[model samples]
Target: MSIKKEILKTIGDLLMEKLKNLPDGLPDLMWFDKQMGQFVPPETDDTAGGTPEAGISLPLPAVLMEYEPFAWQTTGGNTQKGSGNLKFTIYCEHLADSFPGSPVRDLALQHFDFVAAVHQVLQGLQIENVMSPLTRVLDEEDLAPDGVVFSVISYNTTIFDHSTSRTRNHVMVTNPGLEVKYKEESSRPVPAVEIPAFLT
Candidate 1:
């Protein structure tokens, strides 16, 4: 598999392993967070205010690309230069037990653990390896306006940023939580992913 797919696959598998005991399987091979809860509105519409329905289940968050161009320089008479793209993707998810949402500190811990594990795996590889869990952002303040705070960035520049000199690249591993502003996958029923009843 290409580095992109390989990295994603590793993360998806590891997440499932962490919550291996949870039922309701993932739809295909997706990175899932089963322990977390979904966000909900405080007020409801009814004769009076009614209780909100159950929280929405979520899919494995995707790390969208954040691209940057590498600068190059030449010592020729014309002083030529070149540019290459440095691509990044950050994936994250957050939970809301109450109005504001789940505590940020708790999720930060998960982020750290995930990062450490991923880093270890990446460093141990022989061939050019892919990082797992992506890169995590620990600060609640770093979140996007919508609410996503924590994130993991898994990226490869080899394809976009080719080099003639010796390639020097480092792996950055992570898995930080992020708040969700978008809607859930409620309309399309979550597929039946059955686990052994005995485990449940």
Candidate 2:
């Protein structure tokens, strides 16, 4: 896989792992698809190649709102650096005691709990050869009629690109006073040259 893709996958995988570790645990939500290499939401029943039951349950707890990436300017080097946003829409359910026309303290607290959990898990997250993670809470809103509260949190992670060229080059350097050896089947030329004093 390309460096960019790998980096994105690493970030998604980490989130999935953290969610899995949650006490109540995460359901089968369409957070990220490894095969698609993007944040694709689960399809609704009305959509092609999708079952109605799935779409009904989807967008359940968490949905990735955006996975926007941008290039980063570094001091100087061949390595490429970048940053991306992973925005999530977390759904919180109203409490059993919560009633209509009254303050939804239960729902509010539940939403905050989910936000805190995500924040604790994502901060300072590290992947090999990549910068540690940084995250912030964007905002929250209550979706009426459905009785579901939504909160948005954006996670920022550093990306490093070390992609290399596909072409291959063979180099042979012969030092002074060293004899070049070749196999019987080899037809490659052997070029002799003087060796630097420091190298010798």
Candidate 3:
């Protein structure tokens, strides 16, 4: 798999393991696909009923994740590095109650708690093979007409791609040999002079 996909999978797995057992219940985790719209719920038997509107009948307390396209720069040789943002959109139905301190009010505002949990789990998180730890960069909320609240949280991280890099291996030499030699003295005018002086 490509680095992008691997990163997404790692994030999803981490979230799943960390957030699976919440006070409310297990949330539906999904990947955001632009072609399929912002949210796509699990497949159900639609034969009994007509096709539901896109994102209308989505399961409550859903977390949708997607990674934005990043611009890559060649670090060296065939290795490239890219810094990008990963977003998680939390969806929950707004269940308001006019009564003060009602349990329903807590349910209505549960998305905030969920958002905090997600942020706590992801902020400063470092994944294997990623160049940097995840840092939260954005947190915003949007309300839809259908009473579904959207909490979008974004994180920034850097990832490196070494798929096209060349593999290099070095061999070690355990034993080495060495040799040394001395040259004989050049022809000897000094030796002939000494012999003539001795004879004299």
Task: Give the number of the best model, judged by TM-score.
Answer: 3
Best of the candidates, lDDT: 3
Global fold similarity of model 3 (TM-score): 0.65
Query: Compared with the true structure, what per-residue lDDT tens digits does model 1 show for residues 44-83?
Result: 3333322223333434332223334535554333333334
Q: Report every candidate's CA lDDT.
A: 0.36, 0.54, 0.67
In terms of lDDT, the poorest run of 10 residues in model 3 is 31-40
> In candidate 2, which residue ranges exceed 4 Å CA deviation?
20-55, 74-77, 94-108, 142-145, 164-200
How many Å off is the CA of 91 in candidate 2?
A: 2.8
Model 1 TM-score (2 dp)? 0.29
> How badly does each model clash, as a count of residue pairs?
6, 0, 0
Clashing residue pairs, backbone N/CA/C < 3 A, model 2: none
Candidate 1: stretches off by over 4 Å:
1-58, 65-67, 71-87, 96-108, 121-141, 144-147, 152-200
In model 1, what lDDT does residue 92 have? 38
Tell me how candidate 2 scores on lDDT: 0.54
Please tell me which model should have the higher TM-score, number 2 or number 3.
3
> What TM-score against the true fold does each predicted structure earn?
0.29, 0.52, 0.65
